[model samples]
Target: MRNLFCPKCSERIFFEQGRCARCSQRLAFDPLLLVTRRLEEVKPCSNRDLIGCNWSADEKSRYCCSCALTRTIPNLGSTKNRLLWSRVEEAKRRLVYDLCRLKLPLKSEANQLSFDILSDDPEEGPIMTGHSAGLITLNLAEADDLERETRRVAFREPYRTLLGHFRHEVGHFCWDLLVAETQLRGPFRLIFGNESQSYENALKAYHERTDRSYDRAAFISEYASSHPWEDWAETFAHFLHIVSVLDSVAGLPLSLESRALETLRDPYLESDFSALLASWTPLAYSLNELNRSLGLGDAYPFQLSSVAIGKLHFIHMAIQNGCGISACGWRAAPVPVG
Candidate 1:
């Protein structure tokens, strides 16, 4: 993620900062431009500001762009809903930031697969999505840590965090990109199998089956066993997860201040998986050691299968080729399986 700052005060700002600390200026993020600017400079937008949006008007915008994605928001009168909505908005901004950096296509509110947020209850009820509309909706209630943790355990997930959600959904977006293209679609289907299968039935079968053994030869994670499309999405999310984590721990900087900035800009994804594993293996050990000292769980809790390694290498190649950059100045295609 890009390290953002308060333009007015130059104060280091958190990704979710609504107001600058030093300058106290109202801040707004332009997801398309991938920059946060002062709200005062922005002109009024045509869209109803019923949702608590902080986006500023742009040269190409009829409304504040971030507000454009929200189809519905939680009721503001409820304090719990408001707080949860705030967190969702913050995470959504970071997700948009990464998408912009990657030059990924973002669906507008008018299009299918566009982002939406809504809520009805704080527990077991909130935003509904994953229907055929291609919408990625967030239930505002899930933003509460306690509520989310409860749900996470109820769902039997080892990890369930905001970043994970963003990465997973982005996987769905990538599937849309690759599977919709004639050149890539055939290859995708060949690797992932026919996506026309009933998704609900597949999920039901996955839950009902007693065999918990994951097909390590074919999938990236145990959860990937749920379905063919899920297999791809899990792998895709893991690809991003590895890249982002590796980016964070790349190298030592002059100091803490410099380290944070450098971690945000380092080229962890611009190397082959072989080299990455070489670096990450030792680093993950060291990370676990430090976590152990702190009494925290292992930061990464998966054993890298040969198959998984191959998939990582493919992801490495994809990003390198997609960005038109050579991985560590190397000029060869990596031999990795799907």
Candidate 2:
């Protein structure tokens, strides 16, 4: 994200800014926000008023790029479900923007990445959040703060968030599209372990295990230790989180405070993974301290070990191999202004 400006008044604004604060001019939803709004129709998604999605849609389509990928959303018959759908859509839009920044292919040869944001009803049984093939399912209860926090504590997770879930689940889908049956598969197997292992057995054993104090030095999280696929997904999510935060940090005037961030590059476009680590370490510490001051737990609690760094580097290379400068088959990101 960059410092957005109001075109009308030249006042500072934000990507989600509906109206310029200074001028009160209405700003249209930008599907391709970093560069410019491709406002062919100047029309908002049909969901704009219903679910509060503000992205623009082409005249032929009722949905925008983000909303078009959603196969299903929570039932809006109830007030609570409507609120949950709004929150889910908000996070999904952010995930789509991040994928665009990474220059990854949103649609594969046959499998187009999509989402099912559904709710668990008392009579309908519970819905588990996970990924399959190209579809990512998210439990709508994840948007409820109290319920999410309770699950986070119950699972003993270092951190849990709606966006975090999207990143992690999408990581699984990326593995199928980017890693499976590719040259990178061999290297991925070596690093993340062989995915040929029975994932069902791995998951079942993981849940049946009594010990919860296993060493997590090689994994991003304990759940990552369950299976090779999970290890890859967890590491992948962490990499995306790192890049997203670094991108936001680059947008700020942090160079004035830290020499480490003086020559910050576009994190999404940066080739060197170590460069991201260098800027991230200090920022993470500062953020953790800030959270501590407010009697909160560490904002970033995951400790990056050498093994974890290697996994992150693998993800970095995978991204570069797909969308490196001067050779990206896909479009390069335009000058990010938001």
Candidate 3:
């Protein structure tokens, strides 16, 4: 989420901008360089004419890296589905941007990370959003603000959004990528618990329990307590959340003399986990207060306890180590059913 500017006119731009507003230069995001470049001939992505993707394409593949990962999309015959699909792609591209910035290994086409954006059309039955192995499926309905809000209220979740869903499910995929077979597995088990435990039974017990006491000190969310794997995924998701947000607000003049902010670097490349947290704590607190003053809900509703911090450290270490492995060498685990 680094600030981008149009090279033509120097006007501020965004990750998804297709044209520079001031100079009318065509724009495309260069995933490799992690910057928006002005395109002279507008060598737009194949999806550009179809779904409005503004990214540059790979000369060999003719699809942008992010769009290439989409295995399936909802029915485009309906105008509603087309709009929802575009929104989903926008969020997915942002997720890919963060992943690339971290220099993590991405699966190739032989065993690529794929997405299936499905709709909740009655004929298609209910579409449950979840990740399996390297493939992540999302419900297109979640793109609708009202529908997403309704589900958030029903689930009693403090916060939920399309980007959060992408980050969380990708966490599951990364666990399989970076932790499942590595030497880190032992340490991961020690911190998150035995992932070998029955996920189905744990989820059943979680839903049946009457006492919904969430010890924020121990768990990031009540849903995270469903199983050891879930705990790992939730912690992984939060690690991304914290670092990404921190990166966005790192050097802002918040009118406070803070050492952490003064020496802030890119959180993705930050080796010291504690220093990142030090900066995040005060920033999150101030954001929550700002939200309250505006009569809005808390911007950051969760608290990171010592125990939770330990789990995040494990994720940070895993990612730091895993990024060195060759993308093709990593094996994909079988997708768990049920």
Candidate 4:
């Protein structure tokens, strides 16, 4: 979420901007450069004309890097589905932007990362939004603000959004790519639990439990306690949340007189885990207070305990070492479950 500017006029632009307001020039995002550039007719994506996608495309592949990852989209023939699909695509683009910034492995012919955006049609049965292998499936019905809010309340979740879903599901995909076979699995089990435990039984137990007592300081959410895989996914999603939000805040010239903010580094490339937590803890507290002042709920409701901090550190190390590598060694024995 770095501040973007129009190359032609130096006017500030947004990530989703299709044109520069000051220069009256068409704009497109260059994923390789991670910047907005003046749109060139010869390089425009095929989707540019149809869906207002302002991204450059390769000569052989008419789809942009982000759009190319989409394996299935909702029915475009229906007006409602078209709008929902566009919103879903926007969230996906942001997710991809962050992933690329972190230098994570993206989709390729040999190792593909794809998505399926489907609507919850009655005839299609219930659409369960989740990720498997490298393919992430999303329920397009989440695009409707009211519907999402309703489900959020029903689930008793403090936060839920299309972007959050993408982050969480991508977390599952990354676990497969980076952690499942790696030596990190031992440490992962030490912190999260035995991932080999029956996932279905864990989920059923979670739902059937009458006692709602949860160690909020340890787990990001109640759903995270359902299984070790879920715990990893939830923790991974929060890691993305912390880094992305911190990156955005770093771009802003805040008048706060804090040394942590003064020495803020790029969270995506940050090597020191403690420094990130030191800066983020205070910043997140202030943000929550600001939200309260504005009559909104806490911006970040979860608190990181010692155990949670250890888990976050594990994620940091995993991303730093696992990127672009096929294997980081594997551990046959599981550690004591948490």
RMSD to the true structure for each prediction, in A, is 16.2, 17.3, 18.9, 18.2
What's the TM-score of every candidate structure?
0.63, 0.73, 0.72, 0.73
Q: After superposition, how far is residue 200 of candidate 3 from its true place, in Å?
A: 1.6
- Per-residue lDDT of candidate 1, residues 199-266 (tens digit): 88998898787777777898877778788788887887777666544543442121334434444355
Write model 4 residue lDDT over 51-111, tens digit each, in one string: 7787788667988888999999887878888877877887787788879878988753335
Write model 3 residue lDDT over 180-249, tens digit each, in one string.
Answer: 8789999999888999988889988998988878778889998898888888877887777776666556
User: Sort by lDDT, best first: what order?
Assistant: 4, 3, 2, 1
Worst 10 residues of 3 by lDDT: 288-297
Q: Where does candidate 1 clash, by residue pair?
A: 113-134
lDDT: the better of candidates 1 and 2: 2
| lDDT: worst 10-residue window of model 1 | 251-260
| Candidate 3: residue 147 Cα off by (Å) | 0.5
Q: After superposition, how far is residue 289 of candidate 3 from its true place, in Å?
A: 18
Ten-residue region with minimum lDDT total, candidate 2:
288-297
* TM-score, predicted candidate 3 vs. hidden true structure: 0.72
Error of 2 at 157 (Å): 0.5
- Taken over the whole model, the C-alpha lDDT of each candidate is 0.62, 0.77, 0.78, 0.78
Cα shift from native, residue 69, model 3 (Å): 0.1
